[model samples]
Target: MPSEVVVEKQKLKNPPLDLRYLGDRALRQPAKRVAKVDQELRLLAKEMLQTMYTADGIGLAAPQVAVQKQVIVIDCEPDNPANPPLILVNPVIKQLSSQLCVMQEGCLSIPGVYLDVVRPQVAEISYKDENGRPRTLKANELLARCIQHEIDHLNGVLFVDRVENKIALNAELSKHGFSAKAVKPIA
Candidate 1:
């Protein structure tokens, strides 16, 4: 089947999952397989992009759609310029630098939740493109942070897990309509 057809079928058969806005358990479940880029995944990707755009987000993950798949769509295009959208399938971070950068991060799953999470300032990632071709990306700034944050969802990690200061996170969480206890770091 054509990728577009498959994505469309999936959209009809399986609706996108509503993100869980509270609780750590929902945020920790690993995503399932993305069999292929059928019509369903493609439609889901479009809807996700719409959602992200509506919410003023830079990136989104499949798990946020309530789908257990290693897929992420990103458009860090500031001012909604001429840049094309990015669709990553089964993405993996190949390299993480020791240089730490702290930036305020948020999640679609954990709605309104924002916290300063310290992570590598840059990352090298490999994944399948929209056409099922392998591709690699070296990212920085908001793009880098957004990718790392979304990829973490694919691995059952949340921004709160990487938060360096609890008090600041708690404050931010309140503003975002989230509970601070909704996330806890793995030991």
Candidate 2:
């Protein structure tokens, strides 16, 4: 079946949406669950995909664009036109592997700040497709990490907030011109 919303996977000079940065209050606010799947929501997903591709990001949450809706778009293979992007609405993480892995993570919202963050190696999530159909996904490795990271945005969390190395985190944030105070650490 074709994707509910489709756009050429290419970077445009001006994307439809503007991204909120690390310290922006909009990015720090939790997103609201989507009440219904309709043309407007689908359009948002399409615009988000375009913005994500333009920003060269593998995943993006609605909150990152200050939309304040529980929506996410992911495409690990932005270089592959054959691979369809994943648009998730009101996504919920149902399971996470006990096994943890540390991987380098970066975000468009945080710009140049990249750091190693530990997360479950595998994850299972349930969410609605752009067409309002319910679906479940079991993913591992980078896909799992992407899912977790994007979902965290729906909850007003950023990848930097999960960085365990305080020294590295502080240094990177400072170098990137973002305040360490903006990061709300998780546990």
Candidate 3:
């Protein structure tokens, strides 16, 4: 006779984030609801920070968590203890330049897949900080790219959508042993 077996399921410390699909239904238009930087958003920010840290990610957008609001959390200064993680609400990329740079990028949504993507090297963004005070920031380098990437997600654009060359994207996907069968166009 086999010994009696018992198993217990452990709850996830941080629930997995939801990645929105690109479509009319998924396209989150500019929200007029005006998200308040209240306790819920704060808690969400905290969870996102925890999730990002767990995943070793530099930034995360609200859309990645199934929140259809313009929110983002970033901790690009990972080495700096003095600089805490930032939470932006109703973020808007107010200004962008023509200059572009390409960087190999990966997404937490589509795990284990990386591809080169071209984005503006710098951008001026205006958003309400965690305190709900309007703030303007001029970001460059990796920070700029991250902000652009997250903001794009709020507007229903994926990094794959910004791939300058599909062949290159597909090649990279193939190299990683992932299929590019479900590639969606930026709607």
Using TM-score as the measure, which candidate wins?
Answer: 2
lDDT of 1 by residue, 67-182 (tens): 77788988877354556677888888999888988887877666666677778989899987766767899988788898898888888888887887878778877887777777
Tens-place lDDT per residue, model 2, 64-167, is: 99999999999999999999999999999999999999999999999998899999999999999999999999999999999999999999999988999999
- TM-score, model 3 to reference: 0.79
lDDT of each: 0.73, 0.95, 0.70
Count backbone clashes in candidate 3.
0
In candidate 3, which residue ranges exceed 4 Å CA deviation? 1-33, 174-181
In terms of lDDT, the poorest run of 10 residues in model 1 is: 5-14
- What's the candidate order when arranged by decreasing TM-score? 2, 1, 3
For candidate 2, the TM-score is: 0.98
Model 2 ranges off by over 4 Å: none
Better of 2 and 3 by TM-score: 2
lDDT of 1: 0.73
